[model samples]
Target: MRLGTRGPHNPSYVWRSLQSTKELIKKGARKRIGSGCQTKIWGDPWLPDQVNPCIESVCSQGLESSTVSSLRSAVDGSWDIDIIQDLFSERDQRLILSIPLSRQECDDNWMWANERFGVYSVKSGYNLQTNVSDTSPNSPSINWKFVWRLGIPAKVRNFIWRVLSSCLPTMQAFLTLRVEVNNCCPICHNLPEDDFHALVSCPWARSVWNISSIGSYFNSSCTFADWWINITHRRNQNDVELATAILWCLWQNRNDVVWNGKCKSATAIFDSAQTLYSQWKMTRKLHSPQINTEQQTMQERWIKPPE
Candidate 1:
């Protein structure tokens, strides 16, 4: 999990660290071809521990987190000639290397290549070039894992999209609209469709928030984006998690109206989310006595190695 070391290519180390569990990794690769685990090891640049180091390089290069992670996982094992050749095939090798794209271009290249060649086949080709194909014989990375590992891990981003997609009535229903027609605010019926209105500005959404104790903590007319940004950037993990839970409950109420044709109740949603958040925090306190202690210990463990 540390930075790369000088030694034989230890595919096992990368696989074990990224996966962090033997059984999960085994199940993941059970039916895949080639050394499936090796593909994952080669794709990801920053091992679990390599995040900060790799982040430094990406920041220096002005690459976004999602893009950098994707690219890193793409070319990390390219030095393995067998894998490279298989990925390129005899024809592709001649074509791709002949017109070697820049890093940014490579990103698009790999996207298309993965679709056409499949992650497994490309990794197999690379491994074959290095004579390491099926050497260890284990697992392969799926598109979902690649998306998660290579994309932003910011829970807030995921929460935002989830809430928007779930709460927005237009997207939830099967009502067909004109090609030029736009999805607009359901309450105000003016502005473009977005979570901000559904969760923040719409009269109904505001009424729901106002009935809850949480509404008293912020300005009456604040936007959803503002509320989310403030809560996420604050130094409180519990608060962030609580806010997310609240959003989920609010979204669920919206779904009920769409699915069951039932009237929405803001009070019920607020009470449920609040109760859930309180119970979650209480359970965590009871079960995880070491949570606070580990936070302090982690703070103390951070040390700069000698330059």
Candidate 2:
């Protein structure tokens, strides 16, 4: 159960798959201190804090191998405030003192930090994975409200969400996943095809944007998420919808270049976006239920005649 335990030299496929879960286990497991003899204060993750379950303070010269037991008083079996105050930083001292010890003697054990019952479950693991994916340090802060509220198709909104969240399978995304593929933009053959480059910075994409109505919103923002947020904040809902539609079409064109080796003119791309936007708007208008004011008034006046 230790973090450093290695797998067999020739492991089976099941064993390999099981070994892949070590990191997830390491992230969620912490030592539930009992006697504190078995848990190393500096090495083991015994702290209760979710942000950092392990000790953040540097180990003193002679305290490298010190156990949690050393910080406890011999007589009362409580935390030694004087030793903790001297040996650790203010934050570590506070954290160490906050953990309550068991009244009776017991052996130290590992517990799932995410669960109240100290047991691991598949649901908790899945949630941990999802949270990690969504809140990665490398990801930009996206205005999800703006994305989902845009007057565009649900699929297009989802597409924009993927782009903003760095979920799209761009060339750089493939590289990050260790997939062997050319990282250059398939459309422009210039920079590495990342979210920003694929959607905004590629020559083909830029051409389409330059000819579009919302081109003025494009600026020197580093990421597509930033650019989207900036433009949506300043522009109206119609402009946001147009911009989203154009980006979606541009992505389709890029895919055509990547998969079918076909590229469209900038005007063609822009026209496709406009067509898509207008058609969606018209479709919404047609499908939306229109209330007849006269009929509604008649019904209201004649309501509950018998019942």
Candidate 3:
């Protein structure tokens, strides 16, 4: 007999209805060529009779179905209801318990549940749950030297790098040690130290950095030494100006905030630094005759942008 054929005694109503559905969905022509007309034909196991875009609803329902299938596959008598109840939270277990069961179906359901949702199973060597002790073999390990390569000042960089990478628990460890309470920065009163208050959290410093286009280039791991070294080594004139403006603005802003209680905007800082650096350069050129060639050369070498 041909597959899916109806006996002469029975009506072919089911096949006719399937064909109508295929035609209604424009798949009749495709079906005539032997193409399967099911959502699962495209390898999507999760596509329901209707598609739902509400993520939470899909996740909760999908998880329950998968959990049932998992438990049905673990056929050993060693499956423990008591352990499962304890492993999953009350809410999770409640959802699992709600799935219907019969005497014959219980073993299959239990195996599937454990395989799909089981937190622990020794017989199948599949443990679905884990704590910190059992880590994935592919988990990333930290490289201390690669982190150190940023060339931040040793004392400041050590804590800054750790903070940036989430290795340190809190910034207070660095802040409290450095800042003075009486002289605390007006904006961020948490700490009042040169490094902590000046670079990281001060309202004035934050504003200044925010306005400088180069401010976005900064990372907590970057330090004054790192700033100096990279700027000195940079070959491009535009990049050198950008780096110079950032450093100059930061230092000038720090001094202004500390001395005059003035918080210059980032644009103001950038403009002032560029103007000052230009004037300083012009003055040095005019004064070259007053100084020895070696001293003049040293001064020029230190300030000139690296080629």
Give the Cα error of residue 256 in candidate 3, in Å.
Answer: 3.5
Writing each residue's lDDT as its tens digit, candidate 2 over 1-307 gives 4577797887665666577788888889899999999999897999988878889988889888889989899989999999999888888888888999987999999999888899999989967765765588866556666666777788998898788657899999888665779999887787899988888877788888889867744565567777877787788999889988898898898889888999999999999999999998999899989998888776434557686
Model 1, 62-87: lDDT tens digits are 32323322222345522344544543
Q: Write the per-residue lDDT of candidate 3 for residues 1-307, one digit (tens) a residue.
A: 3223444553364554454333222210111101112212122222111122111222333343233233322454233467445445554455434434333422221112223453224532322222111344632333334445532235434554443333332233335333323555544666644443455346556665566544433456554334434444543444444444444455556666657998767668767856755665575577665746787566434566789
Off by over 4 Å in 2: 1-38, 48-53, 56-58, 69-86, 104-141, 176-178, 216-221, 282-307
What TM-score do all the candidates reach, one by one? 0.37, 0.67, 0.29
Which is the better candidate, 1 or 2, if ranked by TM-score?
2
Candidate 1 local lDDT, residue 134: 24
Q: Note the Cα lDDT for every prediction shown.
A: 0.43, 0.84, 0.41
Worst 10 residues of 1 by lDDT: 49-58
